[model samples]
Target: MIKLEQINKYYSLEEETLHVLKDVNFEIKEKEFVAVMGPSGSGKSTLINLIGFIDKKFEGKYLFEEKEITDFSDKELSAIRNKSVGFVFQNFSLIENNTVFENIELPLLYNGSAYTDTKARVQEVLTKVGLADKASKYPKQLSGGQQQRVAIARSIVNSPRFIIADEPTGALDSKTSEDIMQLFQDLNRQEGVTIILVTHNPEMVSYCDRLIRVKDGVIVEEELVK
Candidate 1:
């Protein structure tokens, strides 16, 4: 569903140019659960941002379902991103003051969805992520795992075709992390949402159907385990 060719990202600092990604090329198919593994400075997060349409300054062609999006206008990018992509971050990114229901409802609100439809979608996703009971609770009232679930619910509330998760379980304990992985697995299998996750944990890699390892900003290895 996504492809990148000859991708190169460079940053200029003090008259010195630092290349973040060099000749990075990869493709992710629909409904595929792919894991991106790499050490620090390996450009894993940068690549995710590119795929998620958060970074547009890189030199390369990014095609989503055969349409080149590299030169898409900011408004166009925002539309596509809101409708086609969902994001789960390590920090949870939930609004502290909003209730779980409200946080998950924010996306639909931004998309101009009808109030009734937005309410239903938020409830459905919250239930899907096992956060229905916590709908009225604030972020601070929930545990780390519950907060993460709320974040996941918020991402998928719009039924995005793809999910880009960066260190999704980084702040959770082992058991909670496993639960989150299982939730992602179920989402990919049942909902057919293509999931691309960046993780440093070996255990998380084992849960993915395919693994891609990056070193020095290049994909050095790719393996299909399923």
Candidate 2:
């Protein structure tokens, strides 16, 4: 479970301090698929960063799995990001020169895994994402949908509890986006991985169990779709 209470975030500028998130309170239960929707600059990305453990500077009480976030050590936080959370961005963040297998192996390498283990895990995720045959190809050789599949493969190789996707289908066509959303749904329902997606597309948001809508730095609505 994840809960945020009275969360507030701000950015400092030479002339002004821009408040980005305000009193953002919400609860995401285990195995729930949630979508965060808003227009540009609505703190959607900021909210994703916070949930993904990519941002540490903020004011609020953040509790994850019944533990207070601020009490965790740096190493523990790193473990949370590595072992408990996965992230997929709008832009597929795969390495340009690396083969698909190598890109998926990167996270395990960062986690200090042995070469044999990394290869096994990468191959497993490749098969899971239906890209087992393209492991030898580079990012430039794959289409947008394929590249995003590679990104998703890399994200799940760690078997994270929370898959935080920020506009994951933003760069794809409608058909391809539907495929990706279906994949997310499969992961949530079958694997029971809790998903928090940040997207502007209602078509995409409709795939989720609930929508947490934001506007001008505040949560304006939350609706359950399923």
Candidate 3:
């Protein structure tokens, strides 16, 4: 579902250019679970952003579902990114003031989904992520795990084909992290949702089927974990 060739990313520093990713190349198939693992500053998140179509300023070839992403216009890219990809971040990125139901419903609202259909879809994903009872609660009212679950629910409510998560469990305790990882695993296996997880935790990486290790902005190793 994804293809990258000769991918290169860099950032300009005060004195020199910091090469974040150098000649990166890889492909991820449909329904595949991939773990992007590396130490801090190794460009794991940079690669994730590229794959997610959120960072398109770099130089490379990127294809999604056989179409060249680099060739897309900004509006075209935005359309596909919204309709095809879901994102979860370490910060949980939920609206602090909005109720869980409202937060999850925001995407559909923006996409102009019909009120009835949005209601049904929001409820479905909420239940799937064990947040059905917390629909009316605000993010601050929920614990960290519950908030992350809400984020997960909001991400999948639109039925995105790809889930790109960065440090998904970084803020949670070990047990909660395990639960979150299991949720991602079930989504990958049962729902056939492609998952690209960028994590520093070995336990989280174990949840994925493949691991791609990054260092100095290059993919140094790839391995099958399951």
Stretches of candidate 2 off by over 4 Å are none
lDDT of 2 at 54: 76
Q: For each candidate, how many residue pairs have backbone atoms clashing (under 3 Å)?
A: 0, 0, 0
**How far is 189's C-alpha from truth in model 1 (Å)?**
0.8
Q: Which parts of model 3 have CA positions greater than 4 angstroms off?
A: none
Backbone-clash count (model 3): 0
**lDDT ranking, best first:** 1, 3, 2
Answer with 1 or 2, whichever has the higher TM-score.
Answer: 1
TM-score of 1: 0.97
In model 1, residue pairs whose N, Cα or C atoms come closer than 3 Å (at least 3 residues apart or on different chains), thus clashing, are: none
Candidate 2: count the clashes.
0
Q: For residues 114-178, could you state the per-residue lDDT of candidate 3 as single tens digits?
A: 77778788889999998888888899999999999999998888889899988999999999999
Cα lDDT over the full model 2: 0.90
Candidate 1: C-alpha lDDT? 0.91
Residue pairs with clashing backbones, model 3: none
Q: Please, what are the lDDT tens digits per residue for candidate 2 over residues 72-177?
A: 8877888888988888988999989899999999888888898877877888889888898999999999999999999999999988888899889999999999
